[model samples]
Target: MDLYIYNKALALQNVMDTYGSLRWVRRYTECGEFELHCPFTVDNIRLLAQDNIIRKKDSDEVGFIEYRNVKRDETDRENLIVKGKLGEGYLNRRIVWGREILNTTYELALRTLVDKNCINPTDTTRIINTLILGDIGNFTGNINFQVSYQNLLKVVEALCLEAELGNRIRFDKTLKKLKFEIFQGLDRTSSQTVNPQCIFSKEFDNILDQEYTDSIMDYRNVALVGGIGEDADRRLLTVGSGTGLERFEAFNDQKGISNMVDNVEMAEAEYSALLSSKGNETLAETKKVQTFENGVNLNSNLRYKVDFDLGDIVTCMSKKWGITIDSRINEIEEVYEESGKEVNIVFGKEMPRTIAQKIKLL
Candidate 1:
């Protein structure tokens, strides 16, 4: 692994040989991010800034696709920490930085973020075309709103939630573009499965430890949303809807979805999505596994190698814990140090949407 810093013209600026540690993280619901800790030398400080580019190279392959310096810190003036996000740092850029979009298709809505050269002002051809765009329905009667100072990523999340179609948006580091994918479960045959013992050798264990958690917090019978409109001097309206969860219990939740829509129809649509999506599911379980190489090289062969990515479904078994999970990879965090790299995987089933996700209605 190697770290390279570059200038705006793509010129080699600085390289790190005695860095502290490097971390790369991937989340199912958001963009991946990276941080580099290195000595705060004069040469390194000169190459580090808010707009400078950083690249993590694994052999000849680009590990993070791309990263931009969004923040810098020199706590003791001896070691510096640079923090940033991946794929042009779209999350750090405000929605107001992009072009205005109104009542557009889901595809166009995403395109507007990158089409107007808002993501990267210097490079227009950096975004790749291997996007997994999903349908967001053909309803032209969608809500109307404007982009203020919110980040591009947050806006996209709200849009996906409002679409209410299991839609997801992520920055594909390897593909070098924004990916709009909808959850369609997993294709079992193509997925890699990990067990307490390796598939090739039961003598060599792959799982070090495991744990399980179950929750009913997502269960709800009613989803009530109330918000003020543009012409409101006070609370304008309240809308309540149910998903027929009387079988479970008389559970109810209230949300403030204010100043986000232009009319009642759009507001109702938002409420319906919330009720239908949040009420039907109640049982939630997550399985965390500590493994070697993240179960990648455990069963490798000439023709077969096991690997996993965000949202990929994999099977895990822990005889000690008495748990067998065929779950989706929800989060991944990796740490690289002088000793070696540690990759931690979190697997879960049935994740509930949060209030922050209702930004689409706003």
Candidate 2:
């Protein structure tokens, strides 16, 4: 990918003609952000201080600048964090500012992402309809969502989780649209397989590096979810268990509700889902592979010729590790630089629980 700088009017300012990279990461269950780093120059510094924008472009994707960092004596170049145009609405929301969305369906929540005027009274950006996908289903739920001072990206992620769906955004060059795809369970179906011989090890030219990680924090067998209704005195509790005492996690959702019984029922169902989702303790692996092949580029879009994508289940046999990794593509990081371009892929079923989701409600 190539990085370019643009002015407020969206005119080209500078092309990243120097040595650097346009870095980006995509997450299956969360939002993804972009970054650019190149040789620092006085003009770039001035642009950073002004209304200048940084963008990344390739055969398939595009990114818009959101924040910039300059490294003078400390480093060699300037760096910028870019957000895909599709993400502008979500990233702009304040974490502390919360909004209450009530009586809405899954499709409407998604519409809020593209239809700025529908969700935010002040947003003016045009909605891109071609990029939207998936059905919102028939059930409508009330969200006591606090504009929460949390940015819209995270807030919307939580909303999707509550609805038992997966959310992701990607740039589709064929359609020339920033595609936002939502799935009911896993993101994609696995039709590809990676054998031990295909993996880069001390033997393979395509494999550059690989790392494996395992954690118990992701394993939760017993989940206790509690909530309170409109009346402070009214309380509800639900417990979902998978195994005996391996670990116990509790969630106190204080999102206001009028009915305690209904809220508790919802909490129980959510707890059961959460328990089933996170009930795993296994070795997770991340792989980094070379982008060059016989002087041809392969690690970008063509790399997926093996057929793998975010939330897709794939079988990976690593002889060196003596274990087979069969899981979802939770996250992927792509790096482009003058030295060479490489693709970093991470595999896992679910992310570790965050403190925000575990917030205790009074």
Candidate 3:
């Protein structure tokens, strides 16, 4: 035999709130329950299916299912805790239960002032503006403000059409091309310098001209280091292993050296200020700031605010309440010897009576 339990009162309230009508089902269970013994009809099965609450199989059962008292489930308890923590769950649920209360009362009043002259709910633009700006108070004057599903669909379609037509024109034909004559020359010179047998130098009569080639190559390398052309090579040259000019060029291109020089100057100024102070306190403070800025980029909101006091409080609370509950359950298992019990009590019984109860008290 199959058994099912549902909150009839909540189900009725949901139906009434959605359709604004009471639907009576003859074969289904009610709020306060009773025992029964008979097979239900296909029409009764169809009614349950319509609400998406139950399913029926082609089983030839001989006995009717007993009606049980309606009660809230675990999802309801979890939702209660979530609402309580956020301070909005209770009011939202109250609104669901037909209690008319406005959370953003002041904002609604401001909306009423702005929407004094324009109060057309059926207008797609007006409906969209209200939702985007959260101005529901202006909708009070319009009887159709309580939007039907069909009206929402219409509003979505209108917005989508507007977005689709926004990018109709393209202007690639009128765009200007960047000049690259200087960069192209630099690339040619650098290629010839690296490989003396390149086609450009091969055509020259005095191809053994290392002096002329070296001068042009030096200029090309400098321009390349300054981000001039596509073929500008950026290979590093060691100081002791090469000529002074070559080593200087390589050292200049090494990344982050300029930033490090600036940081060093700033640190020196800060250290001087600290020395002028009575004690090492100011110096320590300045060092801390320098260390933080140098080691961390503090641009992302997540990374910047990660070490805040409020975040620590939330983390501590989560560990204590969320994780500690399981710890306490394990402790209970250690204390309470299950072997002595007469009845074959399952894990479900221990969960609700022991662990869940302890968690609530905590």
Candidate 4:
């Protein structure tokens, strides 16, 4: 597991000097990050610099150096701890301006979002000419997206997660640029016969050290959307339907979603539809944390990235607890240390409910 280090210009500098450990996290819906601990030495300090790039061969993500720390241990050992984020994290440098994408191919909609925010924006000076949107994939369905003054990275990740898609930023060596791509994982679930079924369970002795969570502390099913008006005259609509305990209610304020647009060319009921779409989108983004955290057996017959990869939907069962669920592999953390390397897969993202919990998660 050699880590390739590159200069600020994306040119190969040298391999990371062996030292402590490297914890590289990869995600399906959003940009991932890493923390590398190496011996504190002149060579290591010079090789690891701010704005330099780090990547592993045969991988899509290229991490951007963000923070570097030097520490001296009790044993008189000095070490350098480096931290950074994946390439897609670069989108954090820009914001999503006022835009409404309605009834367009999802691929085109995504490309348009990136083009306007990263490349060829209305504000020419904000353009990142080197970032190119890749060709479309086999994605179908129309999208209605309305965003104003939002973080581009969060918006992109939310949309991709809702749509069950994967996003990446690959460093194109030949083109000397970053290629932004949208992809979907294969359906390797037990019920899907199209490809080989991928199931992880204690029965098969493939799943280990499980930590499952099933909580609805933040779940909501129905949204009572209020757009514009006052008191009894307020415009209102319902996004989802349910009865009794099945109805987890939420109130959505769509005051910014106007029923009227300044231009006459705008279609009728478009704003209303946008408001409804917003409600649905919000609901979809917020869901119960019924996910598990575990690792795969390295000696198992099943192989990663070949039979299953990030974003792939698969079946996981716990015999002791008698719980089985089909979920996506949302994240994977690779640990490389003196003991060797191990990969931990997160079936679903468990959102922390408290500030302290969130900080602990980070």
lDDT string for model 1 (131-250, tens) is 334344343324343344456677655554344323344434554444544443233322343322212111224433333444455443333222333334333222234344442333
> Which regions of candidate 3 fall more than 4 Å away from where they truly are?
1-84, 96-106, 109-144, 147-362
Report how far off residue 357 is in candidate 4 (Å): 15
Given candidate 1, what's the lDDT at residue 120?
Answer: 41
Give the Å error, residue 323, model 4. 3.3
lDDT of 4 by residue, 230-326 (tens): 9998878788877998888888887766555455434546656666776777677667777655556757767878777777888877878888877
What lDDT, from 0 to 1, does candidate 2 have? 0.44
Candidate 3 lDDT, 1-362, residue by residue in tens:
23231121112111211111111111100011112212233333332331122111211111112222223344542111000011111111111111111123222422332232123233334421211122132222111011112232222222212111100001111221111000000111222343211111112221211111001121211211111122334332221222455431222232211212223543433322222221111111111100000011122221211222110111101222222111111101101112221111011111222222111100
TM-scores for all candidates: the values are 0.56, 0.59, 0.11, 0.90
Q: How accurate is candidate 4 locally (lDDT)?
A: 0.76
Q: Which stretches of candidate 2 lie over 4 Å from their true place?
A: 4-15, 46-55, 59-61, 73-90, 94-108, 113-150, 160-214, 229-233, 258-302, 318-322, 353-362
The true-structure Cα RMSD of candidate 2 reads 9.4
Order by lDDT, highest first: 4, 1, 2, 3
Considering lDDT, which of the candidate structures 2 and 4 is the better prediction for this target? Answer: 4
**Model 3 TM-score, 2 decimals:** 0.11
Return the clash pairs for model 3, or none.
Answer: 38-64
Roughly what TM-score does model 2 have, to 2 decimal places? 0.59
Question: Each model's C-alpha lDDT?
Answer: 0.45, 0.44, 0.18, 0.76
